[model samples]
Target: MRLSRYFLPILRETPKEAEIVSHRLMLRAGLVRQQAAGIYSWLPLGQRVLSRIERIVREEQDRAGAVEILMPTIQPADLWRESGRYDDYGKEMLRIVDRHERDMLYGPTNEEMVTEIFRSYVSSYKALPLNLYHIQWKFRDEVRPRFGVMRGREFLMKDAYSFDIDEAAARISYNKMFVAYLRTFARMGLTAIPMRAETGPIGGDLSHEFLVLAETGESGVYCHKDVLDQPVPGEGFDYSGDLDAAIAPWTAYYAATEDVHDQERFEREVPEDKRLHTRGIEVGQVFYFGTKYSAPMKATVAGPDGVERPVHSGSYGVGVSRLAGAIIEASHDDDGIIWPDSVAPFAVGLINLKPVDEATSAAAEGIYERLTKAGIDVLYDDVDNRAGAKFATMDLIGLPWQVIVGPKGIASGEVEIKRRATGERETLTIDAAINRLVAG
Candidate 1:
């Protein structure tokens, strides 16, 4: 992508409404533009980051054996009614009437609708242990939607629904998602701790919220320090094996959100040196709501003994769009966002420091072509902008690596390679720069 042709409306001054660093950087970096309160239009740069995050979430979900299937944003009101939550869901649910005068709603979550899908075609123990997921936009109409995409009225989410024949099977499915969430966040350069959390409107006794610790987080959390360093299940993990033992090391630690925090137990379970109290942003959650929606909606399956019973079910959710903001909150510095390589908008920023100089432009174009040919995602800043402005813009967008091309450097037969996270720079030959990045 070339900045000359990109639609990036970067702001020089911070917006007054942005109370958090991520929101301010997102605005200044021209990632997204607010259309209304808590609503935003993701610009080209923002969309690229969003797509990368979604890709990681999808890949991790697939690794955990969850099948992907997209569900609609607008859901039938009758599905919520059958689950006895249409009215109970409260004002957050955007209730509407269609042209035919039938009630409809923009789904905030998909438990009721997924249950209807499960009941429609799946009806036996043989079809048990099925998990379906989708990445789609959702709306919740927050009464006070603030903090940019972190607390937006409309957002993208990856929600996976699991169906099992019994409680034991449902727990195994929950464990699978548990490990998946760990690997997902870790891949994005986040150490998300799984903590015991209250099942709010989702209505489940068994639930865990994965939270990334940040100073500006909305929720207070308490946990053992070791939980932050615990290793996640590797790629070779067998989903068919005992997932319980796989995640036991992480769950054994004392971790809980404020809603479920037990101060006395926390102190007793963790030594004073190991105890950690901090604010954290929730990135994902897993819930085992056994027969909660299935029983009420008649989602039953025939057992091996030929008896029909309500299937046990669970729901796993990762805040797909919110992660972009949460990641900024956890990873940004005074300069701007320092994106992780796994979810960066582009792997490298090819900055032509002197676009007007024939030698510099040619060198930059050659380097850009080489990187792109090597299957790397590079954003070529071929625009005629000042060197300082170009550097600021590249840093603001936060690509992992920046290859700086200038008349002076190119004349010396070298290009400057800078690491965004560490501000480390090295002058390398064009070939060396390409080899280093390609090998990365």
Candidate 2:
């Protein structure tokens, strides 16, 4: 994407309303625009990042054996009534009524709706272990929504529902999602620790929240410091094999959010030197709420001996859009967001230091074409902006690699290569620069 043709409405100065670094950088980088108090219109750059994040979530979900199926954002209230959460869900639920006086709502979560759908067609133990997932927008009426997309009222979410015939089978399904979340976050360059969490309105005794530690996080968390460095189960993990072995160490660790924290136990179990009390951002959550929604909503399947039984169910969630801000909070420096290559808006930024100069433009254009042809996403600075402004824009957007093309360098048949994260620069021949970036 060329800067001149792109709709990058970058702000020259920071917006006063943005309190956090991600919020400020997002505004200054022209990634998003506030449509209302907590609602945002994702601009070209933000949309691209969001799509990349969604794709990772989708791929991981598929690898974990979950089939994809999109659900409606607006759901009938009858499903909620069946699950008895219609009145219990409280003010965060956006309840509504359509013409003819029928009640509806913009779903905050999809437990009841998914249960209703599962019961409609699935009816046998043979199809017992089924998982359905969707990536969609959810609305919650946060009375005071702030911190940009991090705590937005309307945001994107990747929610997956698993249905099994009984407890043993359901537990296996739960573990699959547990490992999948680890892989998903790892692929995005995040180390997410799974901590036992309060299930809130989801109403599940078995629940775990995946947290990414950041100083500016909303929840206070406590855990062993070494938990941060534990290795996640690799891609070769057998989903159908014993998943308990894979989840055992992660589950046995001493970790909990503020709502479930036990100070006395923490003092007893963890050594003083190894204890870590910190703030955390909840990026993902999984729940095994046996018969909670299924029984109430009549999501039953026939047993092998021809008996009708409520299917045990579980729900998994990853905060798709909030992750963008959370990632920046955990990874950014003074300049701007330092995006993980997997979720970066563009892999390489092609900066022509002298955009108006013929030689620089030609060299930058040639490199951009070569990179694009090699299936790389490159943001070319083809606009007639000052050298400092171009460099600032490239750093602010935080592409992983930057290729600098100037008249002097082009005259010598060389271009500069810079890694955004390390701030390391290298001068190389034009061919060498193209080869390095394309190979990368």
Candidate 3:
């Protein structure tokens, strides 16, 4: 993509309303624009990153044996009523009325609706252990929606619903999602610590929230430091095997959010040196709600003994849009968002330092074409802007690498390659630079 023809609206100054680092950086980088309190219009740049994050989520969910199926943003109010939560969900639920005067709502979550779908067609244990998921927009009218997308009124989410015949099978489904979440966050360059959490309105005895530690986080967390270093389950991990063993290393450490934190137990379980108490942002959560919604909504399947019973169920959710903001919070520096390689909108930013100079423009275009042809995403800044402004813009957007092509470098038969995470620069021949990035 050429910046000259792009739609980025980079802000010159930080917005006063942005209280957190991610919100401020997101505004300045022109990733998103607020249309109302907590409501945002994801601009082109933001959309790219959002799509990348959603793709990673989908990949992991599929790897864990969950099938994809999109659900509607608006739902019938009667579905929630059937689950006995129509009124109990409170003010956050955006209640609506249709032209026919029938009750409707912009769904905050999909438990009730998914249960209705399950009971409609799935009748017997033959379809047991089924998991369905979707990536879709959701809304909850927050009383005080702030901190940009972190606590937005409207956001994108990846929600997966798992159905099994009994408690034991439901636990297996839950464990699959647990391992999936760990791998998902790790792929995006985040070390997410899974901590025991309150099920809240979801009403589950078994629940875990995956949090990424950040000073500006909404909740305080206590965990063993080793939880941060535990390796994620690799790609070849057997999903059909005992997933408990795969997650044992992470669960061995005591971790809990403030809602469930036990100070005395934390101290007893972890040595002083191994204890880590800090603020953290929640990125995802998994729950085994048993028959919470299924029984109430009559979502039953026949057992092997021919007895009809409510199917045990679980819900797994990842804050798809909130993760963009969370990633910024966890990865940025003073400059701007330091996007992880997997979730970066572009792998490389090609800056034509002297867009007006024929040599520099030609060199940049050449490198951009080569990278793009090699199936790399590259953003070429071919606009007629000052070198400092170009550099600032590149750093603010935070692509993993910046390939600088100035007249001086071109004259010397070399180009400058700079790593965004570290301010390390290497001057190499154009061919060498291209080879290095391609090989990476």
Query: Which pairs in model 2 have colliding backbones?
Result: none
lDDT of each: 0.93, 0.92, 0.94
Report the C-alpha displacement of residue 127, candidate 2, in angstroms: 0.4
What's the CA RMSD for each of the models? Answer: 1.0, 0.9, 1.0
What are the per-residue Cα lDDT tens digits for candidate 2 across 141-179?
999999999899999999999999999999999999999
Top-scoring candidate (lDDT): 3
The total number of steric clashes, by the backbone 3 Å criterion, in model 3 comes to 0
| Candidate 3 residue pairs in clash (backbone atoms < 3 Å) | none
lDDT, residue 26, candidate 1: 95
Ranking by lDDT: 3, 1, 2
Residue range 9-110, candidate 3, lDDT tens digits: 999899999999999999999999999999999999999999999999999999999999989999999999898899899999999999999999999999
lDDT for position 301 in model 2: 95
Find the 10 residues in a row with the least total lDDT in model 2. Answer: 244-253
TM-score of 2: 0.99
Ten residues in a row with the worst lDDT in model 3?
A: 355-364
